[model samples]
Target chain A: MPSSKKAKSVRAATLSDVGREAGVSAMAASAVLNGARTSSRISPETRERIEEAALRLQYRPNAAARALANRRMDTIGVATVFESRELNPYFLEVFNGILETAALHEQNTTVFDWQRGAAKLPGWCDGRIDGLILIAPTLTSEAAKVLPGHTPFVAIHANVELPNVVNIETDEERGAYEVVRFLISQGHKRILHVSGVAGLVGSDRRLRGYKRALASAHIGLDNALIIPAGFCSDDGYRAMRSWLQQHAGELLPHAVFCVSDGVATGCLEALSEVGLRVPDDISVAGFDDTLSARTTLPQLTTVRQPLRAMGNRAVEVLLDRIHRQNTGDKQLTEKSIVFPVALVTRASVGAPPAIKRVVPSRR
Target chain B: MPSSKKAKSVRAATLSDVGREAGVSAMAASAVLNGARTSSRISPETRERIEEAALRLQYRPNAAARALANRRMDTIGVATVFESRELNPYFLEVFNGILETAALHEQNTTVFDWQRGAAKLPGWCDGRIDGLILIAPTLTSEAAKVLPGHTPFVAIHANVELPNVVNIETDEERGAYEVVRFLISQGHKRILHVSGVAGLVGSDRRLRGYKRALASAHIGLDNALIIPAGFCSDDGYRAMRSWLQQHAGELLPHAVFCVSDGVATGCLEALSEVGLRVPDDISVAGFDDTLSARTTLPQLTTVRQPLRAMGNRAVEVLLDRIHRQNTGDKQLTEKSIVFPVALVTRASVGAPPAIKRVVPSRR
Candidate 1:
């Protein structure tokens, strides 16, 4: 998209240019134009003249000079793995909060999207950012050990315990428990649980909560009802569709509880394809009341994690740590910060029907 | 959350430390450990030993040093207004593409979120980023004039043309025309248009397209059916709901054409609240095939703007401009790059009902 003609040789206007145009010293011009802390002493008339000159000259404050003087880049780094081409709604919601808070603080946010085995994480700790926030990092203990001590870090849903990083997490087990209990209270005897990856801590916690809730009501755990699925919508769709195909003509579960809103969305689509309607033929619920939950026609009955609030809180805590480190104060030693979750009752869930429905064969 | 205890004084190991541990010169260590371009001649034995020594010392490459050595940060800046706390799906889709391309180029993406009238955009031009991408910037001519000449910039959906900056956009008029024409073909004579802000270029273009499509089909334009709304779902919901309230007992439009998918989703909710079934009662369509379109049941029939492709192209063009600037070559003179749009027919739209239904009053 470049032109063949050469660009003009004129350089951008500098502080000196503004000063010359304003008939003042560069220091006086800088004070008034760049909003330097030392500008309080400048007269109002002089300040007005400097501003006019700056506008006429189109002067821009040099960020490098400011950074060098303040010894701060005023930037925060977000490190995460972009596992797929599609944008993840979970990341979108959390990032919206991060951006909101970072904007309030007038800080820049740099995203570092790393692949699973790149292990290039250590190189990012240099002076580019004041601090780093890790999103659902699956780092091993050994990998975490090599993190640079110079930079402060905050982790959200960290899989392993880092030495000193303060991890922010939600009570997924409790969220799962409440939602499943609510379904059971609606007279749902047979419930299908589309769990996340079998071994992940978050998935396992939700499974425990589901079992605990069922046991409380004296309902035995049906091994056949528990199915393994990954986190995304495609996983939910394939898992549910295949299960329905295999159990064609068999008694269907009264309700299905998904590990994530995305999974629930897929389940809805799969159910629609199989001529079954949500909450009418079979009640369906999901976890994590993300935008997908509300986007659905019969909105999902799910657990609401305070994701945005936690994101805002992470920035505040990270900024505090950055300030402490700059002042040579002791670093944060807290192990983790936990946020509460609530049950969101929406249109997706309903009581079981008087007559049991059997799975119809897929056309 | 900082602890009161004094912190340990140990610093991160550097390349020099790894070199010393490996009994090699710093240059040799740089070649082996940092993957310097000059490292091709290094023997396998030396490379393995250097790697092991680097691992033993836990040495990580310093990004700041590399940036300083190359005199380029290898980072791109994305500036936008985060008007609301919620992440705009438009931003999300475009950003997904930006992130993908940026990752491919091994470049960092730093987001600068500014409030309206903040006007601190110039301060971001200093050395940290190679170039800049402005997302849907609405700069007045005066504001556009103040942009720094030294930094190369590419704008996506820019409202006003900036000097020497390439703007990336889509043919909204055509997209709108095609979708409206499709509705007319489906036997929808009385169609309501929920448009964006009246004066905005995008909104006006869509309006023109709707009129043109109607003219082509020999249908008279109905001023009463052209309602004003903002881009978000709340605006759509409020506008449609209020219209329904006012038009109670009046003949309903055979279909509603919304400006964006968010608005369409809101329209769906509003219609449902009034007990109107989609397609059965009235057909609905939206523009911008964002994720929200698919998330909704009976997914939206909308216009597809290649937002991700546009985002990826912006980065590529920006990178090119950055390179040309570095080489002191010619500057870009192109005013705008326009991408084509297509109609995506999904479940939300269908043939108009045989009978003209009246707007039902709320229960």
Candidate 2:
């Protein structure tokens, strides 16, 4: 792929070369070209000439040279176990935002699909990317021990906290609490909780939030009402359908709070099959306002995670860390940034009916 | 990214070395190790020993080396335009299938977002991948001229057929014919065709099939019922909603044939907004059995393009072409592959009700 015959000698443009051509010192040129030194300034005429010259030469700041000089690749790696699993619209939004932000900062982004187990991950420490972002990594502690300390990492929804990794996660508890509270405010006491995998951090956070809201509202936390579902729509559908069939004549919950949008979609399907209408018979709410939520007939009233914003933020942070790491300062300050979650009001959720709502089955 | 000095000598392992270590000829090794010439067999005992030796050495025949020797990278580049405009489930299915087949062949796959346009493309073709597979590339002939000729190219759902490029597509005409026939069988003579982009091949093919099917049934094609729409849900919604507004008091079509599931989803929304229930007031059918088709409350009865299968097939074929090109057999006899479509029966399409469907507007 290296097209040039003198591949080894082919070098990225340097400030020194620009200065030499512009009859100026390297530091002065660097200041004018990159606007790096806040104290330094160049006149408008000189600045225009330098910019024009750089453009004419197709001057690209060599990434490798900068890394060598500053110890910063200004690149972040996103490692994830996301190949076979459905990467719903949530991931897409966040990733899109990340790409946009990274591009804005003149930083490169590298994505790694860790279809392999975490055991093969330590090799990622070959001084390639300055920092790493693990997206929903479901790795065992033993496997996670392979992570190299040389590079800093920020994780989004890490299943298990790695000792050194800064976890950038949402306040699922507060979001869940507010959503459930909103449902109860409409006088729905028998609220069903379609929970995600029990032990995962995100899943647990949501569950805790749902329970806290119930307790705060003086509502009993019905253990039997919490159905073990998953992040996928099919999982939600199966769990709800099974519950519906098992509890044929029983009173349905006034509202259902699904762990994720995928699950919510499934829950809606199950309700439809049983001839139940959303909001009319049993109100339903979901988390993660993914594209699926909008695509649904009765658009889901769900928790907005601001995934794209987070994605863009993650890139900025990762690049900044990379830049700093290259500057010979690996300050391991334990930093955690939390973004606010908003509840999107859609057609799916409404006031609870006067009675325990019931309807006939589709088949 | 190249960490060590070993990159200079980091040539991929070859079949010859494996054969030498196993005390066999290179051809024999290729036969036994790669399992090419599958019908031919090596001795069971020798085969076992060869396999053991191959495992012991942790041998992965270097892609670049194999590519150089046989003139193939064992890699395919999938170029896609599904960035901001069309993030449909149809693309996901095909991508999954491509991944599945690429893994099976031990070939590497790289996805290029053609949304970036042709400017960034030539840089990607510097011998990294042997062949290119373009998915629904809406490139003008001027843009197509920029494609690198060194590597062979294949296309799926291409906007315009490129000279010397093999195009893989589905029999949209027949699929359209079958779906419309199904609607006709249900006594839907006044069928409305909500079509895709006006001049695109997919649109033309579907329209042809619709007209041909109606003609076959001795039914006349109603130009008034042929509505112009595009790919996205918004386009479908706007088209349908506008149609409703225009024909507020007119008798509605017996059934609506949408070009894609996304459009159908929008159609469902428009219908729901007017309080006209599907099948009860009118029936609806869609093309491309994407995930959205299943996610809808009443699962859509649509034409399945086997997008995933096509994705997988594209990878395999591209790899083969790559190998053939490398080996100096530059001839590609066939220029196209068309997969047969399937009729997925679901809840969306049903017998038309007796009542003439009409959407009542507030105005």
Candidate 3:
């Protein structure tokens, strides 16, 4: 072997090679090594020969063929909606967990982009994968109905009701309320909230929590302060930057509650450009303790949604349901597993200065 | 229907239902709608009845049947080593692109957990997925040889050379050398390097570039300044922090060249903890302009690896190779494609401070 090719081209041996070495039929070798059901009645001597031959040949069963015979692909499909946006870190965390657990069960994990639409999903949800995992799906009720009935499905943070699907959701309402309450405890009043898209279940839940927190504290809801910002960090930056430009000379709120860590990261950028020090001039708290939170200058004070844990748990539940759905004749179980959220205190939130009754506007 | 029952009972009508409702055999219905290759030779009247019956019965061919008959799972596998470390934003970028393109091709992508020995890979390659995409694989040479030859593999940043595999790698050497040269132009003679794992191709290539840049600038290499670090952000933080503590009061290098953006973020955190401002105190440059680069307060001056494009291209190349591999008796092609890296100038770099003379030790 040449030096350049020395370490690179190592091809694995196949079953036919084992069969030939074993002096048995390919089916006999397949039965012993690759688990072909039809070849189960092979002689003991032949089986031993096949096994020994497989060892000598270093035969590895082909993945595609195993799937063909078993009807169990041993692969989980993750259906998500991350596209042009660079906010994939959030999805990546959840996906990492899914991969971790899926691998443990000897399953391969696949991701499906639901950002396109439910129109194209029926084809994807077929015999190819054993089960499908939906992440933050915003499927229309009509389109959701088109999902294949034979396959099992698990959804994370689904916006609408998906029939026969086990929805894994975080308590976003409580998470929002907790962060807002923490901000209030720090002597902050008149807080500004940059929210996610309206009509989105997550956005509504967080907004409701914000309102509930305000009511509990006997603080009046400031309609002008609640703005619908999108999910991306860029959205947070633009939303905050625009607000600052419009409210240039106005009294700033003591704290700004961002909907997600991506938003918080963006808001920090906007603040930096305008020279507003986090927690010093104005406090910032974000929902969802994603990777973005810790990367920021003053690491964000945010609510921790167990995204990875949820992803891992979703795989376990989905796998269980898939086996039951396939082997146990369409057995349906109770739907929805809701996980609690935690408030993660970090450098972004602190006590409001005594002299500054109102926070300074970045503009 | 009550919500509980609604959630539990979503049985999909199958092709058998369509056959029964259309007053024909299941094979006849399959011949009409499932698009099986028994020939597109169904009677026009029977086809119309099958279509009508399918609509009335809401019948869809079982995905498993389609997969078994076609041997086209429409699923691809994505293997990565993300589970071992904290979620890095770098993987997110490439994964997003993979998801987007896979969706466009109507291909479902499965993620394979890469922590298992390469022995585990052959099990996955057996038949579950049509093809495999290896994301940043660090496979041992022995294990690499065990990868199944039947399944086509496309590797992104393959640490070791793989035979019969098309490895997609960024030109980190050029990027590293250019970045260091840029730093050298800023009057920084003693630039410290926080390297990745000692044996990784990326680590050695970056070290070579750093040395090449120093040589080009006529600066003597200081072995003490080059610290051993690894890929993760935490490694960078720990490496730089330990260096800072050990060299307390000594004059800092004009610039610190970090392994990747994740490492750079950790470096920033370590510097911040010590009350040292970036660029003003010492400049830092990162490789692999991942999302963390932009997320950081002082956006990283780094090298962009075109991860998203590489991911998209991987899909194209993998699909192409899969097609060629499946085209009759020809073997899979053994061609390799290398992508170039570009310098990304953000806010992290600045001119070296004039006051280089100092000796202050921490007491």
Candidate 4:
């Protein structure tokens, strides 16, 4: 029955069809339907007839035609890399904000998977989208040089300084510093830092903050205490498990500061496997209070980077640039928009235990 | 410095520039560059020269131009609803699959926020996208009749049978039945079912499964134990919290079967607040083994719907429809694609506690 009904339906009504029904020229119909500047010249009665005809036909303007006339597609492109075939929770949070703001502006959001480099970026500027947003792009200086100038771009946590591209970021170093200092204040002297991938701007900033916090507390930094773990939970789990295996029977760190909530989740799993109780044996803290933070049993005491707000701002800044380009305005816009980060205290973190705990052999 | 470099960059090379460099006509360059049927007429030497010239100029074809020439945009549209300003993990899992497959096919994925209706769908088929994918669309019969005939559509978890559209779905009722049976086998006699929205198909199927399982065991259904909760975590939390408050002195259910992982998370929070440990005090199970399942301290025991594979299939089916429509091929596609669901046993579910547990007062 549904198929029969669909079979009876015809193609969408065009401007010419509406014009014919209203007994007017297609040009006059276009002017009235699209609210063109010449619409005022049409008679009020004729305008009413055109509107009625359009309503009856359920006429909706074609996006391609509208885009051709205005030279604007009204679509924003988002480019990001997926690690291990999974889109992290951080992307979901930011994309939620982007979707909210984009819907408010009546713009469509298209996503493209940027495998590794920015080399394919130029090919994307072929006029299908008016602007693009690069989410945490790690671009080489050479790849950055070849970026097309016609399409506007906005980068969130860009690894390098892109010429004319506005970068939206959080005060990551300060957030790391505050959380580490909080850990130190709780009498955690031997603190281990499970860090992110080396050479990334975010990773480097968080590492610097960790070192600075220890130095300020007059606590010596132990090279053995720093573990190289990537951002994902699997990476954190493997890193923590290996670290424990290598340091078996040695005194465990008083607290652990993980680079991300995902990493902290892995660390928790590793600790639980070794029959160690969190906060009872050692305190654990994570960065980026993503959804994963609250999902954990004791809930992660992590730093909030305001990722959603940053996503919302990326759209606003990109739109501003698009507007300026369209209007031939050359006024400079803000190059960097930095958001503040906060420390969220949760059950995962507590004062160091009175008795120093040693790493136990894996079961 | 980036701005200075950007200012010095020239506009992208056009087809004419490549032709001029190759010492050939623009038509010849177009044939070779685009690999048109006419390319075979040109000599291999000339084609090689044109290719070299193209590489030298770094020329890329304009998408708009190509689309205009081929009557295809090479873009697919995805429409879905966002609940409480958050894109649930369910969407993320499906979207990841979509992104992966879409990349392999070199198609762009544009997302549109469809705020609860099929009425706005017809307006989206404006020649900008080749096809559209509707994610769990709740459509009225009246609205379904007016779906645009020109655009190809594939729905994942569509509530009703859409005429001429392929609907991809999972065996939810079976999944729910198996999980409940598993709980019953663990000696959980009194089970509480936290259901999704009452009228929705997924909710109804899950509810039916619970009743069928109980009936098979000759256990009478307790309407009082069936809490009317929506799909989200907040809904589960609120429903569980209120149910416990209203029956402070009553014996707790042996196990709770939630509609989703998000709801199970909320249930866990509520139980924890009441000083009841999961599996130890009362077992909890959920449907939809989303990312939230593993994030919990004791991961959830739930049903796996293969949402990612469903998403990938939606794209494939939609693309097939688009190709068929474009080539004037009238072969009918499968109206419904039902995928099998499986039970994923984790740490959440366990045997009933040795003694009957009473609901405690809220702290």
Q: Under CAPRI classification, how is model 1 graded? A: acceptable
Model 4 score (lDDT): 0.85
| Interface RMSD of the candidates, in order | 4.0, 9.1, 7.0, 5.0
TM-score of each: 0.86, 0.78, 0.86, 0.91
Q: On TM-score, who's better, 1 or 2?
A: 1
TM-score of chain A of each: 0.88, 0.83, 0.88, 0.93
What local lDDT score does residue A259 receive in model 2, on the 0 to 100 scale? 98
lDDT of each: 0.84, 0.75, 0.81, 0.85
Shift in Å, residue B44, candidate 4: 2.4
Question: Clashes in model 1: which pairs?
Answer: none
Rank by lDDT, highest first: 4, 1, 3, 2
Candidate ranking (TM-score, best to worst)? 4, 3, 1, 2
Most accurate candidate by DockQ: 4
Deviation from native of the Cα of residue A219 in model 2, angstroms: 2.1
**What clash pairs does model 4 have?**
A163-B2
lDDT of 3 by residue, A90-185 (tens): 787788788888877877776666666887677665556788898888888887898877778999999999998889998999999999999999
Model 1 vs. true fold: TM: 0.86
Rate residue A208 of model 4 by lDDT.
88
Pairs that collide in candidate 2 are: A71-A326, B67-B72, B71-B326
- Scanning candidate 3 chain A in windows of ten residues, the lowest lDDT window is A1-10
The regions of model 2 sitting more than 4 angstroms off are A1-79, A83-87, A98-113, A119-132, A148-154, A321-328, A357-363, B1-76, B104-109, B126-131
Docking class of 2: incorrect
